[model samples]
Target: MIDRFLDRLAALVEPTILALVIILLAWIVLRLTRATIQRAVARALQSERLSAREEAARVRTLTTLAESAVRLTVILLALLTILSIYGVPIGPLLASAGVVGLALGLGAQTLIRDVIAGIFIVLEDQYHVGDVIHVNNVSGSVEALTLRYTALRTLEGAYVIVPNGEIRIVQNLSRDWARAIIDVPLVPEEDVDRIIDILRPLLAALPSDPELGPLVLEPGEVFGVESIGQQQATIRIAVKTRPREQWRVARELRRRILYALREAGISAPYPRTVMIFHPSSPQPPASS
Candidate 1:
């Protein structure tokens, strides 16, 4: 019985030591690979013209993705190696894994598509976290992004999850710059040139205002007489502003324009009703 026990222990020692070594080697490889990827990404980004914040975000995103892939591969390889050392047949295991993978691929097509789309989104820099975007008829700020879905926080405080595969059109509202457009309607009898004259100075002075100066990118332009209708004429004014600032600028402009129009005693357009009074059908219908 003692000899039998000793023989079993001897048989286990080599495989156990080999498995430990393989695990240790995998750990070392993972650490080195992560460091190398970080260095490579940082070095590559130095040549691009990006803000410090943008650079950091991209680096972090890419490094995380690469690390995850590498870790998964290394772990699978280490597990296979450990199994083989224990005299487990690997051929059948590999065949079974392939079959399972094929089955999963067919079963999770949507998931695969979403992951692919997410990868492209990150690579193309379509949008990033904290960016205000319009996708799938929903306008919101990106709260988080992952391989399968993107989380959004709408202006109304609703949290939404959207599959990446469903995002066919992406409208990034906070890219670089934005435009503020305001249309002012007036009574048709009002002189458009006079209104433009009043608006020109107000718009020109926008860039000098303390609160709005930083947001304004260029002086406002008045596109006179966009359209003339029976009761009202539309005058369009546009201003270039910093990104995400267009709505605020537009609101401010509307308020200022309202006050100016009121102070100038200019009447806004209102529907007019005409009542025609006629004698009752000449009393022809009263023959009861």
Candidate 2:
């Protein structure tokens, strides 16, 4: 009877110690992973090549995403190892998990797709928070991003939630730089050369303006006479600016163009109307 009891205790003891060792190793690995991730992010952000704002935004976003992925993988692997050490049949467990996964996949395909898309988006560096993007016909600045969805804030202050899978096309307006393109329409009869000459000085001076100097990266370019319609001629001016600065720069540039045109006495095209009034026929009938 004592021999049987001793044998039973020994078996219990071996499994318990093995389980404890597995847990301890998992804990150590998790701790080291966290520390390594933190150090990598810190080092990246501290690099002197990027501006403070750029480093902060980019590092913070990518770091959060990377840590999330790593933690999930570590936890899952640790769970599986612990189960195997406890003599749980991994094959049967995996089979059951597969069945459950299939059911979840059928029911939650959209969710799974979103997660996969988000991972790709992050890995590819498609865009990040604070970047202005147009997706699914909704144009907004990315306010937040996660593995499931992205939150955007439009110019009108409306918040939009977009699932990663639903985004078929992404137009990222704020990446490394942005462009401000403005079309100025004038009467077709106006001299295109005169307009271009008038715009040259004004556009050229944009980069020198203290307020716009930093924002404007590329020198202004005027594409003269973009199109000449019957009534109007369009002159296109495009300028490069810092990311997300194009909107303000474009708006201000348009305002300046309008003011310059008015000062120069340049008139825009207007629809013409011709009226023909016939009173002679009525007067002749009355006399008769």
Residue pairs clashing in model 2 are none
- lDDT by residue (tens digit), candidate 2, 139-161: 99888888899999998999999
Give lDDT: candidate 1, residue 14. 84
**lDDT of each candidate versus the true structure:** 0.90, 0.85
The clash count of every prediction, one per candidate, is 0, 0
**In terms of lDDT, which candidate is strongest?**
1
lDDT of 2 at 85: 70
Q: What overall lDDT, based on C-alpha atoms, would model 2 receive against the true structure?
A: 0.85
lDDT of 1 by residue, 1-288 (tens): 999999999889989999999999999999999999999988988998776766776777678777888999999999999999999999999999999999999999999999999999988988777678999999998877877898899999999999999999999987878899899999888888889989999999988999888999999999888898877889999999987899999999999999998898887789987689988655455555
- Backbone clash pairs for candidate 1 read none
